[model samples]
Target: MSLLLAAPILIPLTAAVLCVLAWRHRTLQRGISIAGAAGLLASAVALFQQVSASGPVASQMGNWPAPFGITLVADTLACIMLLINGFLAVCIVLFSLGGIGQRREAGGYHALVHGMLAAVSGAFVTGDIFNLYVWFEVMLMASFVLMTLGGQRGQLEGATKYVTLSLISSMLFLSGVGVLYAVTGTLNMADLAVKFAAVENSALAVSLGLLFFVSFGIKAAVFPMFFWLPASYQTPPPVIAALFAGLLSKVGIYAIIRTFTLIFSHEPQMVYTIMLAVSGLTMVIGVFGAAVQTEIRRILAFHSVSQIGYMLMGLAVTGAAVADGLPGGSVAAGASASASTSAVNAAIPEFAVMALAGTVLFLVHHAIVKTNLFLVGGIVLKLRGTTVLARLGDLYLTRPWLAVLFMVTAMSLAGVPVATGFWAKLVLVRAGLAGGEWIIVAAALGTGVLTLYSMTKIWSEAFWKVTPDAADLAAAGQHPTDEAIDAADIGPRGVPIMMTVVAVMAVATVALGVLAGPCYRVAERAARELLEPQAYIRAVLGPTAGRPASASEPAPAAASAGGVPSQR
Candidate 1:
């Protein structure tokens, strides 16, 4: 079980080392990357099955006990994330074979890609908060190298901004961890949850929570903190951009969900209210930014920010459900009682589980669809030799089949019916309405309209419009076509690997919508585990770990706010 739990991280790290060793042999490197990605996907599936059958699983490194050793955990949430990461890594690596170009591969491209995958898997499973920091640093280092692999002017410029801001966020995260540790004296997340609740200084706890919020909010690309994303994401290769879009920000979202629900559940009202406001603003800003972008990748980058808002909306609504005493409220209130001496535990309303489930569903749907869109953008770049919208046209005329695939992903992203995104959005909207979060509800609906408009704009300019001839373009006084316009560009031999990968993702996007019920059930189960983490705590700590304190119970004397007692 421990080996299975560690497989996702170990496989990628091992693959990266092998790829680095075979740096002089491009074919060998590619084979190693592909095999490693396949292994990761298999491991993730097995881990998912194990978690489903055995409940939350945890492993302490070097046979050490909890709170004293490095711990890896595989709860439903982590398992779901790992599964998505595995799937994306496989598709993206395959696409890279045809799309990343030979020049880039010679510079250790496969190694960096696998390194990023390892860091991502490590982040998903690590149970210790400090170890999460280490994983984030690994991710930043690998991603920085990937972003600048080609050493192009634009790539260097983008890497500079990405790494600069990411480093700052990392410092903030580390500082927050230090403060949290100073207050609670434990780096283990499960232990922190138990220890933090016993601290007397509620103000200090909330302050530390805000620190984490800002650090992760920047990483998640929410609102004002998202400026760095659009600036840098469009500069990298399409596959790298796709990976960033699909997985990077989602990791931040995952962290937010985990930290808030498990460790910071003590102050639901304040934290969630802030999240609700930020979510609405993030949706508006992201769509508006996308509407103004002329480059294909830049537009997609902005849309990534917009979709994050929907995920945050679900998160805020879940928090609201806890505050309002909705379906899952008992779980939150119970978790809080176990951690602290708070008096606001009186039943106010029933917490709706749908809100949390909607967030998870949205995350899954967005990752697949977003990555497909970027891969499609890569195909466009291959066909037209440019990503500028004005320089591109007539894709639907020259390659109708490719147009079909683009429409599938675009419509899914725009939340069109019978696409996975539509169901994902529907659930969030329903949850918000149920929770009476009218502002966020309006924001979500409005964002969807803007999203559709942006998609249609791409369709019209890039596909519906004809590729104007040199004379027509000259007559219009526009800059001459950067690359000669040719129908041959869309021929089968252009990039079969990229096309195959996009097609697979497109089918998955549609299938997710068609099979929404089962997928949603899985998300619901994951959300339940988040709201009530007693099972998670016990799994990591031990069966002897008692049930979390009930909301109605008086605070235990040993748990007074002065400080955590010395009992281990």
Candidate 2:
């Protein structure tokens, strides 16, 4: 399990090095990169097996114990995320094979993709807060490179804005870490959990929490912080944009969940109310933006922001429930109410557990389907040489498989029944209802319908419409698109073999639909582990029973007395 945990980080790093060193040989670099992706997939499988049999796995790097040195902890949550990351990496590599040709800087592309993989996988597994910041920087750097790979005027403009905003976020994240270390005196997440157990209600805690929230919320593209995403994402190629759409923002959501559950669980009222308000607005505004966009990619990007709102809705509702249960809260509002009783204790964790689990599942499902859709868009571009809905039409006549792929993805995104998306929406909405948040439930369901509307609009314009005007093609300085009269070669027939394999893996979309029950089980277990992080704390702080002294203090005399002892 430990070896498998290391592989997600190491395989990418190793492959990146090989790609850079063998830059002159594009084929060799590509081969190494593909093998690394396969290794990551195999490693994820191995890690999942160990987790299923033996529960969570923990590894301390370089013989240094937790707190003092880096620790990689692979609970069900981390492992599940690793699996998604691995799967997406492999699929994206396959998509890029033909899309980014030998003439391009294949090595640079491979290096950046692998580097981003390593960063995301590391962030999922890291036990230390500072380590998380490091991973964030690494991920941002790689993404910046990939964004600018084509070096077109639009890409350069987009990359500049993207990199600038990301750098500001990173600096804010660092500042938050600085404050956290000063207050709690530990960077190890588990160690800090113990160290700050008593301070979660303090003014400093809320202030620091907001700093961290802003940093991650910006990355997650939640509400007001999301302008950068739509602006920059539309500039990248569909393949890269698809990966970003599916994976990047999810990282921010993950961080928000992690911090709130593990570190700020103490002050539910103040922290939670704000979260709920923001989440509601995020969904409302994001979907409306999608409604207005005519461009295919812009609508998808806006939708990304909106779906993030759903995840936060679950979290906010759960937080509110938990808040009501906190000591000296509104539970005593009525004379008949018992002061000792908490409405939150009765239902909060269950709602939170279910909501978070659903969110993660949704993320995994979205990544694959979204990537397939983007790549399919690329295929459409290649065949018809245009993405604008106004210009492109009659795809169903020529590229039926691409049309089929689009329907599957669009239906999945639309939350149709018997699909993985339905399951995700079911979990999220049920969670909202369980928490008594009817407004959120209505919004979520309404968003699902709106999503369908937007998707169907594209379907009508792009595939169902009459054949495109060859005149538009001539206006755009391109050859008139032939009606894909041939069936076999209709959808990218002459494209590289690897692209075909990638398109085939879109079958996972339907497979996940079929396996929703078991996957939900995984998500539930992962969420349970995340909410009750005693195991993580124990791994970091030597099985201590109570919170540790401040970070500046020497190790507790008896390691077990505190939550976990730093082995380092």
The top-ranked prediction according to TM-score is 1
Alpha-carbon TM-score of each model against the true structure: 0.91, 0.89
> Per-residue lDDT tens digits of candidate 1, residues 1-568?
7899899999999999999899899999999999999999999999999999988988877766677678798899999999999999999999988777667788898899989999999999999999999999999999999888777777788789888889889999999999888876678887776667656566676788788988998899998799989988887778889999999999999999999888876664777889899999999999999999987888999999999999989988887667665333333443445542233234322235788899999999999999999888888877666777776799999878889999999999999999899999999998888888999999999999999999888899898898877687568666433221123343345487888899999999999899999999899889888877777876776654533541112322222211121111
- Predictions in order: lDDT: 0.83, 0.74
Per-residue accuracy of model 2 over 1-568 as CA lDDT, tens digit each? 4577788899989999988889888878879989999988888888888877766667677756556777787778778778988888888887777555343454388888888999998988888889999999999989998887767677788788888888889999999999889877778777666566555346677777778888999999887888898888877667778778767888898888888777765554777778877787787788889888866777788878888887888777766766665565423222112221243235346777888788778777777766676776667655655566777777888667677878988898788987788898899899888888887788888888888888888788889888656686567665323211122233454455534744565678778888988989988887777666666665555654323232335553245234322322
**Lowest-scoring 10 consecutive residues by lDDT in candidate 2?**
332-341
What residue pairs clash in candidate 2, if any at all? 541-564, 541-565, 542-564, 542-565, 544-562, 544-563
Give candidate 1's whole-model lDDT: 0.83
